[model samples]
Target chain A: MAKQFDQRKETEYSSRDLETGCVITDPGNAARYKTGDWRSQRPTWNTLRCIKCGLCSLYCPEGCIAPNAEGYYEADLYYCKGCGICSRECWTQAITMIEEEE
Target chain B: MMTGKRIGMESSLGIAEAVKLANADVVAAYPITPQTHIVERLAELVANGELDAAYIPVESEHSAMSACLGSAATGARTFTATAGQGLELMHEVLYVASSMRLPIVMAVANRALSSPLNVWGDHSDVMAVRDTGWIQMFAENGQQVFDLTLCAFRIAEDPEVLFPVMVHLDGFHLSHVVEPFYLMEQDVVDKFLPRFRFPLALDPDKPLTAGAFFPPGVYGEARRAQDDALRSVRPVISRTWREFEEISGRSYKPVETYRADDARVLLLTMGSFSETAMLAIDQLRERGQQVGLVRIRLWRPFPFTEFRQAVGNAETLVVLDRAISYGGPTGPVCAEVKAALYSEPKRPRIVSYVGGLGGRDILVSEFVEMIEKGTALAESGVEEELLTIGVRV
Candidate 1:
């Protein structure tokens, strides 16, 4: 790990202060690390059955579900981990868990 | 001239007063033997409306330290106290507290770790957390405890060195013992330690994360950065000590030496046992034994320069450690001394002894005996790495 990104030399310490560790210089960088690749099972929201109650969004473990322009809820695959939690938690049975094909 | 109020008080109360005077914003703690008095007093102060702060009676030491991390992240001046098992329970969080650069002040009433459930004085607890990257210090008495606790905040909160600081006092030996000491007035303490201003607070307006997870790509650099910060805190510690001396008329040094000039033999100690070792040195000097004493006041950042100078040209250096390192070189302090003086041009032969475990009393006479034994061994040139003294066979 040190062989990479350790551009600073030891001599630099004499004139410079240490880079404070893991301090969030940029806000909300968690969005950059895409966890969608980890999905084996993904949740598909049935927009007609969603009822626009937002229960699927509320129950999403990864918080990847959001409302579409038509006031219906949909799953954002970018941040979803395919937890199936929203599918199980949907009282209206508006979400369905589907296996992702290799 | 003694500044402010001069009164007799226990070491625990003295530290509590120092924290109160520093005006800590949040105190989260769980009661443990030897360390209870400090937090209890703080709790009382909070309950009585004397100190306007949040007093959290956490479920456990882990929760206590976790709460401190949360409170400190919000730019609050956080304080906590723990000992022995309590410290062990909170062990994991110790790393988080320092790595996050939360400037929290922790008072550790040093105690023996329990298998036998011993709650007395020893260095086992503090030694365990040595690698946590916190600025560590040891106090010999009530006055030192009071003064150092205040200095801890200033040193930890310094913008150049935003690290946690742990002030360790021997459990029961210092904490329970009452002694006369000078207490600085609230105004004086205020002047000495300014209100801690943390640049990165968990504010709603300026949203930022404190302890973000590091990937393997940058983990090593992150650690190097933390270590660099730790190693560079000496100047800040010195400046804080100097400022404190000016305010309180009390002098403090990283490694304090006593009557060691022109001595053939030197004895090294830390925490309260250093006082007993001093008495032993005085007696040895009266008999012309040519012996001296060295007490380590600042534990972490190891004070290598001061320690080497303190040991000087002594032919024999005897280190008395309160905690054993089990099967290692001898004791924790002895191993550190040998490592620190390894490449010195004229280093003294170190004789390591582990005694005073589980609150066992290490009398002045015992210190004298250890020095004599070490001197004899040094003359013989026999390599005895570590020895346990005064233990029942």
Candidate 2:
């Protein structure tokens, strides 16, 4: 029941249909909410300097960074809030924050 | 009516006993005047092993309420007490408790707010957090204080209604008064208030986010949900009172009336002054005046339907407020009463009065005089924005 409710957008739910106290009954449902829309700057990673160390993934504030198929660390833009934490924490400066285009 | 022992005890101590009887799991509170005695007694109960509960001595009222929120989230039967400035300090956290739908019961010994630093009884503190979304109720005397405090837990923890409850008794006036009242047995109380089991309690096995932030897209809906939930709690409150009446032989209502059947003039009051107003009504009736009294018991949901019915037939209503709205309508309660009756076809002519402020006494004779003045004002059609009683100036 909770998972089904989580699948619907917040705006789609009416006051009567919402859970009591607006409590999110489903745990770890934050993954469903794409907080990346709030980001003005997106992270870009250089594969050469990445070294597959996964430091950027560990430092990502939103925990949206992960190792891609090639073992290079990449930020999942769908959930990243453009905090630039990964860029700042990258030991080799492999990640850089760039302004998003309209 | 199961006859329990009738004993005289201070109102504050009675409230503490009520909490103990309810078997509260957590009591997190800071000491403040008028409210201190209740918490002090609870602390003593915890110390003496009379009540098996945690007594957290917090640094400030803010921490006290915050601690209650945490404990309540974990499905604990939480209780606390505060007055005046302490209540003001817990202002912000008060909303969180209600919005989260935690069934925490608080006894507020209503006192005057400082500036003049008067540690006296008044409704100033109660009026300050009027819109904080708690289930607010007023207790007229020591027995009512004890009864209502017990009822608060049952009403608040009802699965249908999970709002926090505030049992407000006038500071010093009601809190310090020693009165004889029947104390319910622990076995009876245990049967009345079932073990609280919050459906959305914080548990490691079944995780859920409580009080999550709602952005602009959902904030209005969230507020609407809360408002509807609170407004719909009237039935639960009435039902709880009825169930309590069965065992306790005491009856309570949202709006209680005294000889209001054919009353042409009505005097409305709240808190401890209601009893005094009742005496004044008896005097007015003896003087051949068709007067009655109406005291508001449930304050939060406002009891619009019952209130309208009670005052609809009266020719005039004299509302005495313990707190001033300052520059606005003069009386916070008066403004609400007027608004509630604005659309009624047979509404009474309301004469607003702000009195009994900052611990000032309003004797029975004084209430009679005030009522007479109000009736005269209503009859004369004089547009006085505010009238104050017992003010020397």
lDDT (10s digit) by residue, model 2, range B102-129:
9999999999998899999999999999
Q: What TM-score quantifies how close candidate 2 is to the native fold?
A: 0.96
What is the TM-score (0 to 1) of chain A in model 1?
Answer: 0.73
- The B-chain TM-score of model 1 reads 0.98
Scored against the true structure, residue B185 in model 2 reaches a CA lDDT of: 92
Best-fitting candidate, scored by TM-score? 2
Candidate 1 chain B lDDT trough over 10 residues, lowest sum: B212-221
The sequence of per-residue lDDT tens digits that candidate 1 reaches over residues B224-256 is 878877898988898899889888889899998
Error of 1 at B20 (Å): 1.7
* Segments of candidate 1 deviating more than 4 angstroms: A1-21, A37-60, A63-102
Q: What is the interface RMSD of each candidate, in Å?
A: 5.4, 0.8
Candidate 2 chain A has its poorest 10 consecutive residues by lDDT at A1-10
